[model samples]
Every structure is written in structure tokens, then in C-alpha cells.
Target: MDDPIMKHNVPDTEWFDRSSLRRMLRTYSLVYIKPDVGRKGNGIIRVKRLRAEEFEISYKQTTSLRSRDKVYSAIKELLNPDKEYIIQQGIDLATYRHRPFDVRVVLQKPLGKWRTTLMCAKLAPRRSSVVTNVSKGAKDYNLYRLLKGTDQRLNRSEIIRNLIDVSKQIAQILGSHFPLKILGLDMGIDKRGNIWFIEANTKPDCQGLKKIDRRLYRKYLRAKKIMRNG
Candidate 1:
């Protein structure tokens, strides 16, 4: 999923390591280091290059200002020896009321055709949190309402169309190799209105969508029924 998106619209990402971390930090200024098998944004770290040699590593409730080597070592110590990690270029995501937010594009396969069923925005509770995971104190909002007054440079309707198209594309690509029923594409929109694929979730949680819009939730249920009947 990321491979197709990366070739086109998504941000640059690579496996995390001392060498790659140093290179990506130089290239991206701000990069995210995340565990390969973590959820709810747990064990995710945000690394930012501040000066020539100074950098910052921010994890849950901890932000450390240190030199390049020290920052690397600190991250290394926090990592599990057996688990893999990834380094991703961080996009300065769009903000709603001073808090960073990201869109969740939900796509479902009904009658063997992919359809975009739901679009919800998750806003971080605080500016310090690294992710907008609903489990991490993030609040869900209606996608259209969230984009209502913030930035008007980009056309909202067009953005929504693009998001749905890309999400369906991702689902189609992933479905080729596996039996994909639904996808929850975590997407970020930059200040410039460029949409980036942050990540993809195969078994997406719909609790946020249910809380935000029951109509969309009912639609989602109908899609699931089609899947089950088929």
C-alpha cells in the first residue's frame, strides 16, 4: 500500500537505523521513528533536527534535546532488540484550533468493488502528542466540518475526492495480493493542501466514525452486510 502511494503522493520512508536515521534527519529535518508492530501510536518517536548538531527526540511524555549521537543512542535504548523499526518523513499536518489533525479514509469492498464509505478527522488532544490516534486522547470530528474554516486555499470537495480515490487505489492494490475487505487509510494534509499517506490499516477501528456520524456508520454496516452475503 505504501509502495504505490510513496511512488506518487506519500512521503519518503525507510527502515530505521543509525545510518538511515542520520541520512533521513538531514534530508527531512523532522522524521518519525516508529516500531514496526506497534499500535495506538505507542512507542512512536518524533525526531527533529534543530541545529547543526543538536536534535530533539520526543516520545510519550518525554522530549529530550540532545546531540545527534546521543539522540540516536537514546532511541536505540528505547527499542526492543528483536523488533524492527521504520523512519518516516514527517509532514507538518494541518491544524484545527491549534491542534494537529489527520483524516481517516475508510474504504470497503462490496460486490467485489471498492467504495469509500467514511471520512473522519482525528485531532490530537495536545500539541505535544506525536500522533492523532483515537486511543491516545485524540477527538474525532466530522471531516467536512473540520475543514470548514481552517484553510481555504484548497477546494474542500476536490480534496475529499482525491482522498477517496487514493484510498480506493490503495485497497485495490493491497487486495491483489491478499483478501482485503476493508481499509482504513490514515492520511495527512499539509499546510499546502497536499495529501500524504501516513499509514494503512487493514482491520480499521470504526468506533470514531460511529461516534462522529451515525449515518456513515450505518452505511459502513451496509457495506459489511454486502461482504457477508457475497
Candidate 2:
């Protein structure tokens, strides 16, 4: 049972501190800094390392820069060079309502095989945050409601089915590539409806099931018959 989330740390990290991070950004042109133990979208910073005479810093939708000495001071105050943190390449996120949003696809293996049960679109609040997690002030828009728009072109059932299919594809890839199951996937769909996996969760939240889609519980009743009928 290899962990899917752990697999993202492949080929070893070259740099891990603000100094190293800043240097890496200078060498590579861009990088993303995320908290290793952060949850609910806290302490995530996106920085662009540059070769400018006065280097710049950016995080959580705000961009700024200080002198080299000041940059080191900020890093010393903000990051733990010895602790776990990640500096990843940035992705061009897709937009929803003029702001960025991400999809949370819930998956489960009732009897033995994986199945997608629910999908949610978490939209970031206007001018408030970079993440769309509810704790970050993002709204939980009903996938069911979005499926009802005639002008949207995608039919209700088709939309749901596509969501499920895309989720399954991701799960299968992770299982084969990383071998972790029961993942809560944060995915982004560009304006063209292309799916991009942002990250995977080992512990997927079931509260959304309890609060939003209780009827999905009944699907488990058939779990007993999954192997027998298959």
C-alpha cells in the first residue's frame, strides 16, 4: 500500500528553504511553496524567483519584495528549513465566476472495486483567498444545479457520468503509478473542460455525504452483492 501523496516527492527536492527556494526560482523561473502539514488551505505561498536587481516575493495573491537581507529575514521568520515543505512548479489554474476554482471528487471502494460517488466544485471567494476549500471561504456550488443549465450544453446525466469517469481514470492512474486507494482528488478543469489533477488526499471527507448527498448511502446496500453479481 504505497501512499499516493508521498509519490509526488520523487527524484528528491533540490531546495527546501526560502534562500534555496529563492535561488531555485532564479534558476528555474517559477516555483510554488506549500505547507507540509497545512490543512484547510493555510500557509500556502506561491513565489516567483527572479534575477532582477531587487528580487521579488509573492504569496496568497499578494506580491512584494524586500532587499536580499530582508528576504532572508522573512524566510527565517516564516519557514522551517529543517522541517518538511514542498516547492513545486506552478499550474495555470482554471477559472470559475472570474475566480479560480477546483473540483473535489470523492471516491470509495465499497466491496472491492473503486467507484466515484460524488463530485463537488469548490469556488474561491472573490478577492479573499487563493484556495477554494470551504474553510478558505469558498462556496460549495451544487453540481446538480450546474447540470441543469440548458445553455451549458452538457446534459445532467452526461455531466455526472463524465465526472465519475474522469475520477475513476485518475484513481486508476494513481493506483498504477502510486498504488494508493481511497483518495480525495483535487482536480481543475480548464475553460476547455480538460481535467488536471492538483493533488490527492489520503483521507477523503465523508461529511459532505452526511450533509449534502445522503441518498448515496443507499448505494452501499448493493455493496454486499458487488462480488456475487459481478
Q: Where does candidate 2 stray beyond 4 Å?
A: 1-30, 48-63, 66-76, 80-82, 144-166, 173-181, 209-230
Write down the lDDT of every candidate, Cα atoms only: 0.85, 0.60
Per-candidate clashes come to 0, 0
| Model 1 pairs whose backbones collide | none
Error of 1 at 174 (Å): 1.2
- Pull out the clashing pairs in model 2: none
Model 2, C-alpha of 65: deviation from truth (Å): 3.5
Q: Please, what are the lDDT tens digits per residue for candidate 2 over residues 10-126?
A: 212344665676666565545556667667766666555455645466655677776655665664566655557766655444554566666787776655578776676777787
Candidate 1 local lDDT, 85-194, one digit each (tens) = 99999998888777888998899989989988888999999977788998889988999888886643657887888888777777877788999889888999887888
- In angstroms, the error of model 2 at 164 is 3.9
Whose lDDT is greatest here? 1
